[model samples]
Target: MKIAVIGTGNVGGALARKWARAGHRVTLGVRNTTEFKGKELLDEKNISVAEIEEAVKKSDVILIAAVPQATADIVKLMGNVSGKVIIDAMNSVRTKPDGFNNSFEALKALATSAEIVKCFNSVGFNVMADTNFNETIADMYTAGTSERAKEVAKQLSIDAGFENCYNFGGDDKVALLEQFALSWINLAMMQGQGREMIFKLIKR
Candidate 1:
């Protein structure tokens, strides 16, 4: 799969590396080609850097891990995204997009041509970097109305080393998913429980 990562921060960098190692073509979309948050990612095999518009044009899927407030601007830069899947990994914890409560809402409204889903926002970037704990891989959760987008997100989560990507339901559950991410943030950062811990589901 050719994936365009809109943000080269910790979360974006970690997932890019994982997918590159998994044999996927990962293009890092950045405002500046020479300097970005995760410039080192260019060293990884199957990973390269491109200007935002070009990157989006070359990829079939897009993973947005940018700041919540920058959602509108980012979507504007992504040319035409019809028939493409967009996986939003951003959360509105500290701030939100201009006219929306969360990144997912902003993307849904602005990136009208794309299939959007929310995933990879509930866990820390460290957890994303290494999903294994005592030989058990962590589980990921996603929510969106587009089944196509959800399926793409699930496969990308698996490519990033997660054990499974659970569907948390449809578009209405998007806000709830962000709240779930807040719960993880509260536990890991506020409660001092550490970022190494992760979430998984078990059934009989």
Candidate 2:
């Protein structure tokens, strides 16, 4: 899959490396091609950097890990995303997009032509970097109105070494998924569980 990753932060950087290692063509989209947060990612095979618009234009999927408040501006810079899959990996726990409750809501209004899904926001970047814990691997969760987008996210999750990508229903569950991420934050940070914790589902 040809994927464009916006925001070169820890989350984006980790995923880019993982996907590249998994044989996916990962493009790091940024405002400046020469200098960015994860410039070292360029050394990885199947990973390259490009300006935001160019990267978005060429990729089939776009993973947005940018700051919440920058959601609107980033979508605007993406140009026409018609028939594209947009995986929103941002959370509004700290700040939200201007005039929207969260990044997903903002994308719903602005990037209407794209299939949007909320994913890769439930865990910390370190957890994303390495999902394995002894013999068990971590699971991922996603929520969105578009089944197509959700499937895309699921495969990407697997590519990134997650054990599974569980669906959290549809668009209505989007906010709920963000809250679930807050639950992880509350435990890992607020409750002093540290960052090594992982969310998993077990059934008989």
* Candidate 2, pairs of clashing residues: none
lDDT tens digits, residue span 1-204, model 2: 999999989999999999999999998999999879999999998999899999999899999999999998998899989999999999998898889999999999999999999999999999999999897999999999899999999999999999999999999999999999999999999999999989899999
Determine which window of 10 residues in candidate 1 has minimal summed lDDT: 193-202
Q: What is the per-residue lDDT of model 1 for residues 19-130, given as tens digits with 9 covering 90 to 100?
A: 9999999999999999899998988989999999999999999999999999999988989999999999998989999878888988988999899999999899998999
Candidate lDDT scores, in order, read 0.94, 0.95
Name the top lDDT candidate: 2
In model 1, how large is the Cα lDDT of residue 68? 96
Clash totals, every prediction: 0, 0
Global lDDT for candidate 2? 0.95
Q: What clash count does candidate 2 reach?
A: 0
